[model samples]
Target: MRQYIVLSDAPWRSVPSRTQQLSARFRGEVLYFEPPGASKRSHRDPGRQVRPNVILYTLPSAGLLPVGGGLARPGGWRRQGAFISRAVLRHGFREPLLWTTCPAQVHLLDHLTYRGLVYDCAADWSRLSPRWEGDLAAAADVVFAASPALADHLSPCSGNIALLPNGVNFPMFCRSDLDPPRELRGIRGPVLGWIGSIDERLDLSPLLRTAREHPRWTFLLVGKVLRNPLLAALQALPNVHFAGRRPMVEIPEYVGCFDVCLDLRRKGQDIYEIVPRRVFEYLSTGKPIVTPLYPGQVEAFPDVIYGAHGPEEYSLLCERALEEDPAWVSQRRKDYGAAAAWSRRVEEVQQILGDIGLA
Candidate 1:
């Protein structure tokens, strides 16, 4: 069987990531490695078989050591690298394909041999060191970018970059028979919801203003809320509800309760480049989605989503989205979701790999 060794930046959890989804879909056994920062306590565990053919191993976090060029101190890298090598041999992973999301994880090249290396660039990591990202991109046999902007950003680094935007499990989010989560049952009015990490990257101004303007309409924010200054003001609004974070599987139940799905992200060139994976999930539900008119979003979405700018336009678009969603429109959106499903994305990756003779 084909084998893959994935060095992921995020932990393998109930909330699936691109790395986890793609790896699980590969027609082979996968030895997935979660970096040390994900969890320190799980470092000593042998391995967790998260899927039938995917085993997860967590590396020890070098909390006390200085990390440079993505490697911990000499002892730290040596021990972790040795551990990975042992695991590779135990799994009989000979010349396995290597994949990494983090640029810093490139240091693992010193300890492992792979038939080919794939770099999946899902986020902006140039802040760590552009040189590191450049080096990793240069070494990668292929690079998959999550957005058009990201592809453009990384084009200078690699000639073989391809667009593999974030996607959703279409069947999961499109279930219409799901019962609404208990959190929404008590609420009476129409719910305008935003699901994902509620962090500083979120532009709460438009949402805050809209919430204040329409007290009768419930504004549902379902996700982990980070330290944002406007959160208190939002919490103070009686109509606003924070359902906290829910498992990826349960998100559709929450979406079922939403009258209109809202995408509120902070305005910036950087933020514009990010195509939130939740957007695809939202589309899967065939729900009326109202989002900002970010760069390339209108072209990317075209007929599928409603775009607005600022509070005035955002408020108006929400009204339009609620009123304009007909059966045909909803079906069209669902079609978009079907085309952008994780399964299709995995297939696209495989096709590209085959073309490059890496498969």
Candidate 2:
């Protein structure tokens, strides 16, 4: 079987299911590289493994400040350098194919004279600096975009750009026979849950407003708190419950516990083209989703309850979602399930890779 290395600045657990699914499809080994202390509690350090056929590296977020010398002026760059120095550069791999999930790492590709591909999976390019996009376009042999809008923006730079949207692990998120964990079971009222990093990108104001408007409902947030002050404010609300970040394996249990799932993306120009991972995950759970309507996203997921600006629309949608019969909701979830399967997505990616000679 062919071998591949996935060089990421962080551990695999952050995007576990996606990494595992890709690993299975390529039938290749993964060589993840994280800073010394950044290893996940459950998995082995991927850097310690032997070299593989490909090196997939994730880039730093462009929203971050620029560090000196073209490095992201943030902590991630320092961490990334540690991994690259200790694991990647130190190794002597034979003609490894390079794939970068980060746009920032495109500059680093010049140092590696080998077959390479760049997967610019982020939907936040409109928010990214023009220099970063230019660097990515110049470095990547094949650029995989996350949406059509993103592709349009990148078209001026690379002809090899391909639109590959996000996908979910079907079996994990799909309606399962498994029982819900004890912590999730006792939640008395309708649970409006949102799972993801609580950051500025998230418009929790509307969710909080809706929660306050409908005091009877319980709002559950399952993820790490990024903006502490903002999150603390959200926590101050009586109906909101911040669950912090849960283990990846426990995510499905949390999803299964939701009466309705939320995709509360803050309305921004960058978010217009972004299709969040939670949308597919919510669909897989066979749960109704309440989200803001973006042109690109609505085109992909028309069944979602698209809320216009304001708490009234959001609250009404949540009420409607909560009122739906469990059987009907399950069928809607199945409808979404049929549409966003990873198998189909992987096939699309495989075709893209083959066209670019990366497969």
Candidate 3:
């Protein structure tokens, strides 16, 4: 058996389900080391053991701090390096692959030596801090950018950059188009739905204004409220219905209830170019999408109805979607769905690992 260790901030639930699925395919056991409860702070921490054929480090988000946060600490990268160094000292595995979404980890590369490093640029992290991102790009051995535009941005730093856009779990989102569950059945006519955490990244103002403008159209907002102010303001909108967070198994049923879907991401300094995972999930549902226009979005999903960055365009797009034929949009979604499966994306990652002799 080809053994491997997945070093990440624990409570494994925080890690993306796609990453979990990919790890399982490698015929390896995953050991999640929770950051808050990690054995030690520095790389020399004891009680840490590294006995595996391969050690894969999954980096954490740079901006979000740990629970009870005081200045965000380095848990993912630092702990990973500690384990890798220990493995080198004990078993002599000289090179390990550092797979990370955070661009800041690039600076720490000088502190440790590995055979090669793979930067999974899941989002346009450079937007957060351009200078820091440049430093990170210079350090990565291979850059797997989530989109072609992201790859282009990192091209100046690494020649090995590859475009590996986000993929969907077909089975999870693409359920039988049966009626929605009883809880969602009461959501009134011309239902336009949006599902995701109520976070700073969500641009709910446009959705709120749009819902108010068209009183007949009910807007269903799903997912938990991470930020209270945003949730409270959205709840005040008379046409908007807050479904709150439901179980993952029930998401599709909620999505199916929508006559049209919404993927309204706030055009922030961090997320303007990055595509949200929910956009793909909404696409998988074969519902017409009313999304904000951003750089590279036109190329990413040419089929989506691009709304201008304000309430006017958003309201117009929603009205257009409501009037449009569902069958035509549904067909386009099915076409796009086949190409954006998680299985395909994982295979690409495996190929990259094999090329670098990490697989």
* Candidate with the greatest TM-score versus the true structure: 1
Between the candidate structures 1 and 3, which one is better when assessed by lDDT? 1
Which whole-number lDDT from 0 to 100 does residue 30 have in model 3? 35
Write the residue-wise lDDT of candidate 1 on 272-344 in tens digits. Answer: 2667888899999898998877544534686878878667888888888768737758998899899989999
The lowest-lDDT stretch of 10 consecutive residues in candidate 2 is 34-43
| lDDT: the better of candidates 1 and 2 | 1
Among these predictions, the greatest lDDT belongs to: 1
- lDDT tens per residue, model 2, 299-320: 4665554554566787888888
Candidate 3: segments with Cα more than 4 A from true spot? 1-11, 14-80, 83-96, 107-114, 124-136, 177-179, 226-233, 269-272, 294-299, 355-358
The predictions' CA RMSDs to the true structure, in order, are: 2.4, 5.4, 5.6
Candidate 3: lDDT over CA atoms? 0.63
Q: Would you list the C-alpha lDDT of every candidate in the order shown? A: 0.83, 0.64, 0.63
Stretches of candidate 2 above 4 Å error? 1-11, 14-25, 34-46, 49-93, 123-132, 226-238, 267-272, 294-299, 325-329
In candidate 3 the C-alpha lDDT for residue 137 amounts to 66
Sorting all predicted structures by lDDT, with the top scorer first, yields: 1, 2, 3
TM-score of 3: 0.76
List TM-scores for all candidates, in order.
Answer: 0.92, 0.76, 0.76
Q: How many backbone clashes does candidate 1 have?
A: 0
